[model samples]
Target: MKVMRILLGYTLLCSQLCFGQSKLHFIVFADTHDRSLGQTNLKTFHDLSSSIGFVNTIATYAGLQPNLLLYEGEKCNPKEIDQLLTTLVVGKDDVIFFYFIGHGWNNRQNNYPSFIFGNAYTDRATLETISRNQYDIYRRLISKQARLTIVIGEACNKERSDSPPVISKREIEIMSPQPYDPLKIKALFRNWSGGFLLSSCQRNQFSYSDLKGGWMSVAWQNTFTELCNDTYKRKVDWQLFLTSVQSKTQKTAEKNEQKQMPQFELSILPFNGSTPVSNIIPKSNTPVSITNAPCPSIDSYVNETALAGIREDLPLLHEMYDEIDSDNAKEYAGAFGLFFQNQRNFYNKLGSMVFYEATGIPDKCRPTFDKNTKWVFDSTNEIYQRISVINKYTSNPNKLVQQARSDLPSIISRLEEILEKFDK
Candidate 1:
């Protein structure tokens, strides 16, 4: 009898440890004190707060703990962020979600935008001191090694400039009650393992907002609420969620006579645990089609202008091969060579495809285009970085190098123009 009682006690302890509840750490940073964007920022905060509450309620129902750390108005500064990062502790089963909404701009050094925590009263130097880039924050959060890390920054990704205040009579509302299955919620939150980084707009683009809130934020909250309330869906598809958010945001921006497109990077690892396969939501398996088809201009430019530009630049690119002295130079030369050689064939295949008027590329071909464009962007950026390094080495740069450096920005701009036409 004594041995059986000891065995039963040990079994219960093991069960408690094995089935322990996970935690969700949500952090929000909002620059609500900025005079120009104060109202919009406040509205964003309220919307996100309600969203967090709904998440918390669902998490409780699913037997998970939820915690929120909010920094807004005067507290939204570098010092506070540093302190939060230093003290925050995350378990392996925990989820870390960091969101920021404020004025931001692209420094041209990276694809992501830099947050501007300064208000109208703050000076330029002080503003620079307080600013932090979205990617940096994402990296820091991921370093904590939580089960899942999601970082979202909803701000303009253009050159540094003051935006005029936007006014709207729309009022904020809390998330309404809906029939949500706790088991589905648990699967949605617990089945994923990876990092997700999202930005409001592409590089050199401006994000729009009004007193109601940021277009991206409002769209995200709405989509997320809908997903949670959906009882029929057994698993959450992140790719679909991102696509929905992007489409809703673009529509909202268009309604206001502005153009805004959200961008994201998702890296999901396969699950190898003992959890049932039914509960696991694998990474981005579902195909996501673009909401708005690419404009006719993209097809015309790629075939008529872009291909010719590449052909013309091929000779110069080949000539630079001999001047490649460093690893960076070699990499740049190689990437440019591949780009010039394959661009014609790639575009030729695209040109041959019959595009639908309503949906640019067919569902099967959209992924190929997306993958190729991403490679182009990455290769172009790599070439740019190599040029910067080569310039440092050669104080008296050669003519070919100088010309390549000067023309690279135009090339990037043209690429951005083409990508914009994709409506992604």
Candidate 2:
């Protein structure tokens, strides 16, 4: 009965939206906790993807077609994540859209590693690590004859508090607008549209919940849907959603994520604090007024409040060299190095964003920090090779490099120094 009421309300809302706001078109799929699409799971994810404003934005408000409500009917897969993200990028301008939900995984090798319904398993890395490249996917979507683009990623960020590393957002910019490489899927997970990537946790942290008897990430699951369905129909602010999710997740821990404590985080790019984008939308040629963009470094954004996000999240540049020292970890180090190198590029682009915002948009919208993204494929590639070798070997033979890590000062200082140099 309740579901019917909600669906009915959505139909009514869609009717009104025909002449209402043309800003956002959100296509959501939620409760995707599964290895396959069973009838039960299908029902859950189907409702989730739509109940939230995600469905309303795409269908009711924006009124677009082929706009999907669910993919494979609960057969969550990497491509499903890609599909909604790509579709939202279509025709998006000025309005903000969201992909919010929870997921889980278990790695006896290293506590709970975050899970995508269907993705190649990654080491217990941060979401920003994943998102650094996903930006390219959004880039491809926006390039398709759209005036402006904005993305909101509210996926749960799961890291261990004891682990001390969590997810952080990186600046991703595409040199070209057109899709560069579909085969090169690395860029697909990055969030480079210069918009927001607000996950539930930082890099290596955990996201838990206790709503509806242990749904994937209930904090967002319970409230987000109803809020977006509001008669007021106001799009919920990212920060506001985070604040609410945190409180709700904690309360529902007995039932959500099937754990006692839940950790959630909200991050933003060009975040001015105190409620982001509060009823404000930037329009084409209207000039995006920005401040402290291109943050001299991550610390620029990591003050007391930002610290709450940072401390819980991953240390910016630290641990980047972890794979470098271990001969075994070296082959994989290329990917890890890629993580930091990508961040460096992002940091530069952020500064460039500031410069662009202060000055007028660049002649071609090029950010100043574009030069930093170059990676010496040879050196890093060599390390990447070693990483593979290490993984193959029984034990790591690169003790000499690993031992030198003791001399690199503290991880915090090293990370701080890296942040400072980028500002310089």
Candidate 3:
């Protein structure tokens, strides 16, 4: 009996020691070809091939295998890109990463920045029309699905000159009708939360590509890879990853006698503190599905406050559960009393918070939260009932503790599954 009790205590302790984490889904694509509907005068980028290689390598290392890797000839028009991103369903806990490496230019009329997709627009006027409205559309599409949307645009927003420059000039004369301010383009995402826009260079500054691939692409690839190797066992710090990419790419641009400093904006609010991407585990070998789930309709936009709260609280709850169960036989009576009191307090607090949020939900989204409230009430009741049954086994206090410890895992697993719905 003593040996079995010790084993149960060890199992409970191990559960408390375990870490809680989640994964991110990444999509990487590049527009390197110049089709212009079969125009022979188009200029194709040979350097973009390296962009593909870097995305694949980093995606593999990070365990966020790309859901879509659109290369040359892939449909990248504003409507098509928007349609593709809109198809995926993102959860509040998940993040979406969209990376583009190709030609970008400011409209000759209004200076709005736009990325050129393969064969999308033939004339300058057509490209300008698409560029004018595409930024807001893209930002909203990506932002709606996930908790965070990260965009990495490694392209130059300059005039389409008769001849592209060999080296970027530090100071270029302002040309009206073309927007040269990177900050202006970045401002499009100012109102959104959990958005990070990383542009390869400031407005008017040019991004370079060579046989080695894009300078920005190479820098980010190296940064993600090195973090994996350096951390070995620890989770990679997302902030550090972003900083390293900026630093390395800046160095490369300086070496080429260019002042192509990368510009970025990040607006994610951390739940507790800094958020880290966990290391890729063995189970992450499978790739994420590219096919979109059924698009969520109007009532599907559920608030994730309670779900996020539960996820954040689980680690601490596990610790408390384990500690209360570890008391020796002599201390069992007192420990059980304290455990019951704490359990009631914790659940009441969490349950009431969830109920309050559910009741106050606006009319349009009431269905989703109403369902979630019932789920919470039912699950908590089951937990309370299980604990009560365990407490009734007063004749064999050790057996009571063992049964409760054995049952807690399934209850926790059920709660986790419930939380995962908010992500999908």
Q: For this target, which candidate reaches the highest lDDT against the unseen true structure? A: 1
Q: After superposition, how far is residue 2 of candidate 1 from its true place, in Å?
A: 42
Name the candidate, 2 or 3, with the larger TM-score value: 3
Q: Which scores better on TM-score, 1 or 3?
A: 1
Q: 1 or 3: which has the higher lDDT?
A: 1
- lDDT digits (tens) for residues 1-424 of candidate 2: 6996776567546544542433343434343443322333344345445454234334433333323434443444556666655554443222344343435432111111333444323343442333322233333434452322334333344322233122212221111222112111111111112343334443344543222222333444555443444332444554565566556654553333333333322223332223333233332212443554432422232223212322322443244444344545555444444443323322223322222223333333333323332222232233334433333332343542453244323434433433344333
lDDT of 3 by residue, 1-424 (tens): 6995675456434423431122344554455444321111112222222444433433333333244445444554566565665676765445566666566764321112356654433554455444422244345545454545777776675644323435332332111222112222112112223655677776556776554556676676566456544233444445666787788878887777777677665555443323422211111112322234432332233434445545655685476457545456436635554555434433444444344323323454447555645776677667666666766765676776676577667667666766765445
Separate clash counts for every candidate: 0, 45, 3
Q: Give TM-scores for every candidate, taking all chains together and pairing residue i with residue i.
A: 0.58, 0.42, 0.44
Q: Distance from true position, residue 255, model 3, in Å?
A: 1.5
Judge candidate 1 against the unseen true structure and give its global Cα lDDT, from 0 to 1.
0.62
lDDT against the true structure, per candidate, is: 0.62, 0.36, 0.49
Q: For model 3, where is the 10-residue window of minimal lDDT?
A: 277-286
Which lDDT value does model 2 have at 81? 65
Give the per-residue lDDT digits (tens) of candidate 1, residues 37-103: 8778887887666655545554454455667889999988888888887889987777787888888
Q: Which pairs in model 1 have colliding backbones?
A: none
Off by over 4 Å in 3: 1-24, 35-66, 69-71, 108-112, 119-121, 130-138, 165-193, 231-236, 272-424
